[model samples]
Target: MNAVLIALLALPLLGAALMLAPIGDRQALRLGATVTGGTLLLAVALAAGFDHGDPGRMQAVTDVSWIPALDVRLHLGTDGISLPLLVLTALLTFLCALYSVKKLPAGPGGRAFTGLLLLLETGMLATFAVLDLVLFFLAFEIVLIPMYFLVSRWGSGKKTAAANRFILYTLLGSAVMLLGFLLIGVKAGTFDMVKLADAHGAGLSHTTQLVAALAVLVGLAVKAPAWPLHSWLPDAHTAAPTVGSVLLAGVMLKMGTYGLVRVLLPVVPDGTATFAPYLGAFAAVGIVYGSLACLALARAGAKGDLKRLIAYSSVGHMGFVLLGIASLTPTGLNGALFANIAHGLITGLLFFVVGAVKDRYGTADLDTLSGATGAALYGRAPRIGALLAFAAVASLGLPGLAGFWGELLAMYGAFDPAAGLSRPAFVTYMVLAGLGTLLTAGYLLIVVKRVCMGDPKQPAPVAELPDLQAHEAVSWTPLAALTLLAGLWPALLLGLSDPAVKHLLGGG
Candidate 1:
């Protein structure tokens, strides 16, 4: 069974290799889709075989020595915490592949882009599963290379500059993170995460624990792209292709928060206790700041620009996920996970729609896209327009949608933190985050009102316009349906996450 975990990562890499061997063939795209779907099916197998009754313990453990002297080993497995994220990585990759079937433009190097995407999924899945710090870091950094190529080679709008900036920011943080990981390893005398987390910082002094925690925070913060460190995300997201944007927002961002939860909290419980207040503060600030930024983007779109508006919206949505994590309570962690998955589904759908709009309209300028003329699908493409409207509503955290629970739960967590957290400050934070909901609703509605309501006054030449096709429907419905289902019955995820949350909180 443990071997199944190893196979989850290996299968994708093998599939990527096979598909790339005959890269230029017509079936290459289908092969890539098949392989990615297979990886997802493998994840489903794990979910079914998993003993959900006891979610705290790592199930199906695989351990072997890779570096005897430093005591690193090829340790990989799952707990309830890692399971949802792993499954997310699998589902997103498969849907993204399916989405790309007819959607992505075939540049000269088309096959390579598809291959790198598959490889990237393998890297992300492996990083989540590996239990040794060294193995974890390897898988983590391996993902960066492929994504860099994915964006630099295939992305749009100042691709060279965006990719270089992305590489510079991420590499710097990775170095710092490695230093922090090394400090932990050197001090604790091993790289096995389960053992070290169990040791609880291995008796490090309180001050040392705080410093290590800060180091880990700085490293993951870069990836989380929290308020101050978040400058790189917009350009990278704005310029990247639709597939890159989807995976970046949906799966890659989770890497940082996941690190905070899986590594920082457990290894440096003392430091987490000391720094939780500051974490909450930053999360609250990011929420407000990101909300304002969204309004500004809406303002920019009101002037007629397109991609930048959607890119800015990503910042605001992810703010909820960050704020949820900073709450430091059972409800907060679950809210954060809920937001993580919900945002991935909604925002990924948002990007896909944006991409389709760009493809048909020749520009994404809000004012110009009246949708009444040639692009006017309200009468012609009412279903497409309606679907877009539904996604926008869900994204704004409308009641009975997937996005609602996360923000609501985050507020719940902030209002009443765990025993040791700062109650008064988080209470204030809760009020502010709730206010952010109005701001979220504003921009999303502005998007719908501006783009979907009026008749297409100035036709976007028919040559440029086409409605949503069959394959796109195949890719889109599951995500939208899940978003609605989760919203209606929040228990599906809440029930799954409860035991894991209890374990993380040192028992509920």
Candidate 2:
């Protein structure tokens, strides 16, 4: 079991190395992604083997002394909370890699991009698994480096400037976050997250605790790229390569939401209560703002802003997670956790489709792209168009697909918050958020009409091509299946998360 834990973390690192090897063939890069996916299958086995009745506690426990003199240890395990995110990280990483098979740049430039993505995948697994705070922070930081390079080097248009902007903003936030970690370690005399969460801020003064909480929020909000701080995301997403866009949307942003759950809420419950409304306000604005921006972009018919549109979609989806968290109810918490995976899967699929469209049509502009959706065009690429529709509609929280419950449950929880939360305030937020959901529906359907409706027409006349190739079929079909599975049977996810939520809420 310990060995399995280690393998789960190591597999992608090894995959990254193999892809970067001098062999230098695009086929080999793609093959490497498939091989890495095999590790995810191993994770699925772990998930199946999990003892469902006892899913709350860490299972498949593995601990090793790494820096005992300082009380640091290499510890990794999964509870209900970590399980879904881990699975999502693996699924999206695999799909992102698969997407790379077709989405990469024309030459040697593509090779390094694949390697960095694999490394990012490995880091995400480690960050989600590590139980120790210092280790978690370290693993968390590891996810940033490769992604910075992925954006700066292989990114498009404003790649260097965008990457620099992303890094600078995150670094500023991370500095404050690191200070928060050190404060916890100093006050609690341990760097273990379990130890600290178990302590529940008992060792620190109110002022001290609040300061640390704010510091951590600064860093995490930058990553969550919350309102005012979210400027970095549009640039990064627009400039990033397709696979980078996939990983960034699918898993990296979730890191911030996860941190809020893992660190701020548990470690500083009072601080969280004080700041919850403020956080919710930022999130609400991001939702309305992101959705509106996408509509404007689509309306203006800009060719290059397509990926940015999807990026804004992320802002809107994450707002739901924030809403759920702010509600401070088990249902909302569980819903947010589920949405993390749902959004990752759905948005990852969206980027894949957007990438494919750009590859085929050379642009993502709605006006310019009108004829591409004609019936004959669908005849030519029905699979891709259908998949895009699936992703876009699901993103709008379509009832039967993977995206349904987060907003519904978030509002439910808002109306009936846990005993500690302010009911009236949260209810108001919930009502406003519900209205935002309607707006979300509006924009997503617009994208659907623009991209998937018209009869087929050749923009200027060109050779015909087939829908999703074998690799795409492999990557997208399973996500679609899981989306449907979770949509129909949310119990598959809520069951795992409920216990963990219970523990976290009780100040675990």
Candidate 3:
């Protein structure tokens, strides 16, 4: 098991290193696809071996004293919480690599691009796998360089500025978060996350715990980009390449919320309780704020970019994730965890479809996409248009789809928060979040109608546009299938998470 886990982290890094050699673009793509695919297979094997009956306990652990002087260990493990994310990272990266095979990004060095993506994959997997605070932090920071380069080098307009903003904001957050980790490590006499969470910060003074929690939450929030701090996301998403957008939305953003469940609530329960109300308030505000931003952008007509609009919608979806975490109940946390995966699939597909649209038309501008006066998509490419509409519907939290349960369960969590939280406030948040849901449906429906309905104002061109290509269908079908599968049977994710959440909340 330990060897399997080590291989999971190592394969990608090794592939990345190999890509730096004089490999051809085809070789690099093959290498990347093989490595990521292997990682996914390993992840599936790990899942199969996982002791589902004991989902709450960390399984397949690999612990070794890496730096005794600093009390930092080369500790890695997974439970239901981490396992889902690990698999998600592997699956998305694999799909990205698969996509690249048919459609390599236009650049001088496709090898370098593929290599950086692999490196990013390794970092994300490590972040979810490591069980030590210092190790986790190190893994957490490793992704910055690759992602910054990906955005700056491979992205579209304003890519450099967007990458710089992303790096600056996240780096600052990481610095503060590191200080909190060190504080807890020094005060608690260890940096093992599992141990610290088990202790629940019992050894630290109340003030110390509060301060550390504040710092850590602030840092994580920047990644979560939760309201007021989410300014970087829109620009980054708008500028990033399609694969970058997919990974950013799919797995990277979840690190923050995952930290909340795996690190914050367990290691600083009292502090989490102390800050729950404020977190809920911020999350509620984000929900409405993101929805309004989307609505405003949709109304912007030609000025509105579909990718950017989707980016804003992410903020709203993550707001529900945060709101669920704030509820601090097993149901709420489970919903948050479940929502994390759901968003990954739904948003990843959305980015892919949008990327295809941009590729076909050279622009994702609403007015341009709508043709002179009517929706040009269906007329231009019916299959792509249909896929886009399906993704939009799924994203709008339609029932019997993956998106529905997360939002539904989150609202349920907010309506009846765990003990110690003020019910009236949560109830108020619940009401507001519900309103935000309506706004979400409204904007998404408008987007679909504008982009996928009606005839083109002009006659169809003599050259027929391509529909969903083989690679696009291959890359997108699984996400679509899973969206429906999980929607109809949420237990696929919720069951995996519920026991772990119960354990984290001390129910066991």
Per lDDT, the best of the predicted structures is 3
RMSD of each: 2.2, 2.2, 1.4
Clashes of each: 5, 6, 0
Residue-level lDDT of model 2, residues 86-162, one tens digit each, is 88888888877776776565534656777777789888889888988788788878888898998888777878899
lDDT of 2 at 68: 81
Model 3 stretches with alpha carbons more than 4 Å out: 300-302, 456-463
TM, every model: 0.95, 0.94, 0.98
lDDT of each: 0.79, 0.80, 0.90
Query: Which lDDT value does model 1 have at 79?
Result: 82
lDDT of 1 by residue, 94-183 (tens): 988887777765454657877788889998998889999888888879889888988888887788798888888888888888887888
Off by over 4 Å in 1: 19-22, 300-305, 371-377, 461-464
Q: In terms of TM-score, how similar is model 2 to the real structure?
A: 0.94
At residue 443, what lDDT does model 2 achieve? 77
Clashes of 3: 0
Error of 3 at 388 (Å): 1.0
